[model samples]
Target: MHSERASLGLQIAAIGGLLFLHLPILLIFLYAFTVEERTYQFPPPGLTTEWFAVAWNRADIWPPLYLSLKVAAVSTVLALVLGTLVAGAMARSRFFGREQISLLIILPIALPGVITGMSLRSAFAIMEIPFSVWTIILGHATFCIVIVYNNAVARMRRLSGGLMEASADLGANAFQTFRYVLLPNLGSALLAGCMLAFALSFDEVIVTTFTAGQQSTLPIWMLNELVRPRQRPVTNVVAIVVFAVTFVPILLAYYLTRGGSETAGGGK
Candidate 1:
């Protein structure tokens, strides 16, 4: 009886925790359909799909959304290339201060978002670099690289060195070995990392704020709308789009990385 009671309590706790975390997100979805334009009402006076059309028709939304997509794509590409190279070196090579190097690579992500944003802003100002989409991509890549590096290195560490040795012994050149052997093994990790980096860059507000200058990404645009709302439900509709954009990639990344430690090496 005690064991059964404990299990029931644990299930209840789990359900409560999920609700606590996701209830606000549910509210966002609910309000997106609300007919009230200027003010929020509990249980919504009426529900309609009109806000979705309003959000779509708004002239201000498209440019920011396009810029965000562009930045995320460029940043993800850069992160994948740089991060994979760094991970390969870190996983395969041994040298003094290697651990320190790894820590430094990850330091940007470990720091608070505000701190990272401030540092990037300062660096740009000192360098006389203008804030633009490129600057946003640069700021985002700092942490995006960390995500890719972590995923790649974790997969690499689990990989057997013998696989590379076997490829070499089979008369495969350096490029051939990488293309035929390492690349296949690293594919899923890279994909997962890229997806995560893209998702993060898409929704990022803090670093983008510091780096954007006069430009706006979708999140920044949303903030502006909240501060000076033309239609409250329209903002909620945009929020739903943001939620979907970030959530899908993150969910896919989770599934990809969940069994990531299982290495594809040698015969196995």
Candidate 2:
């Protein structure tokens, strides 16, 4: 009886935890369909899909959305290239202060978003760099690179050095070996990292705020809408769109990285 009660209590606690975390997200979805345009009623007065059309028709929404997509695409590409190169160097080479360098590479992500934002803002101000879409991309790439680097380095460490040596013995040139052997091995990890980076960059508000100047990304636009809502349900509809955009990539990344550690260098 005690064991049964304990198990029931544990299950109840787990359910409570999940509800606590996800209940607000559920509310956002529910309110997206609400007919009431300005206020959130306890049980929505009526539900309709009209807000979807409202949000879609809003001229202000598209520009920020387009900017966010562009920034995320550019940032993810930059992160993948730079992070992979840094990961390869760290994984394959031993040099003085390597650990310190690795820590520095990851430091921007470990810092608070506000701190990172402020630092980037300050750097841009000092350099007299005009804030534009490129500024947002640069701010996002700082942390995005860390995500890719972490994923890539973890995969690289799991890779067997022997595979590279074997490719060389088989008369594969450096470029050929990398294209054939390393690329295949690193593909999933790099994809996972890029997906994660893109998702993060898309939803990022803090750093984008500091770097964006007169521009607004989707998240920044959402924040502004929340502050001065013209139609509350329309904001919720946009929130749903943002949630879907970020959630899908995160879900895909999770699947890609699942069992990732069990790879080519399992014995090693």
Candidate 3:
């Protein structure tokens, strides 16, 4: 009887915790369809799908959405190349200060977004680099690289070094061995990392705020709209869009890596 009560208490706590975390998101969904637009009325006054159409028709939202997609794509590709190479070097070879370098590689993700944003903004000022889409991409790449590195390096460390040796013994070049052997092994992990990175870059705001001087990605647009909202329900609709955009990839990444090593990089 005591054990049954303990299990029931644990179940209740788990359900309560889930509700605490997800209740706001559920409210957002509810508000997106709300008929009353100016304020969030309790029970939302009335609910309708009209706001979804309003959000779709809004001209201002499109540019930011496109910009966010472009930055995320470029950043993910850049991270795939750089992060994988860094993971390879750090995982396969010994060098002086390798551990320190590895730590530094992952530090941007660990630091508060405000610090990273300020540091990048300062560096851009010093270098006289124009704040443009490229600057946002660079800011995003900092953390995206860490995401890919964590996943790739975790998988790479588990790789058998002997595979490379045997491939070389059979007259395979470095590129060939990697293409034929390592690529297959690392494919799912790299995909998961890229998906996670893309999702994060799409949702990013703080670093993008500093780097995107004239440009407004979707998140920035949402933040501004919240401060000075034109159609409140449209903003909720967009929130739903962002939630779907981020949640799908994260769910997929979890599925991809759950069967393998623990390489689905969560926040540090």
Best by lDDT: 3
lDDT digits (tens) for residues 1-268 of candidate 1: 5454557889999999999998888999999988888788888999899888888889999999999999999999999999999999998899999989988997887888999999999999899998888999998988889888878888898889999999999999999999999999888888988888898899999888999999999999999998898899989989989999988987787787675563212110
The numbered model that scores best in TM-score is 3
- Relative to the true structure, candidate 2 reaches a TM of 0.93
Off by over 4 Å in 1: 1-7, 262-268
Compared with the true structure, what per-residue lDDT tens digits does model 2 show for residues 163-235? Answer: 9999999999999999999999999989988888898899999888899999989999999988998899989
Candidate 3 C-alpha error for residue 47, in Å: 1.4
lDDT of 3 by residue, 1-268 (tens): 5454557889999999999998888989888888998987888777799888888899999999999999999999999999999999898789999989988987888888999999999999999998888999999998899888888888898889898899999999999999999999899899999999999899999888999998899999999998998889999999999999999998888888886657485653
Error of 1 at 176 (Å): 0.5
Question: Candidate 3 — which pairs collide?
Answer: none
Better of 1 and 3 by lDDT: 3
Off by over 4 Å in 3: 1-7
lDDT (CA) per prediction? 0.88, 0.88, 0.90
Extract clashing residue pairs from model 2. none
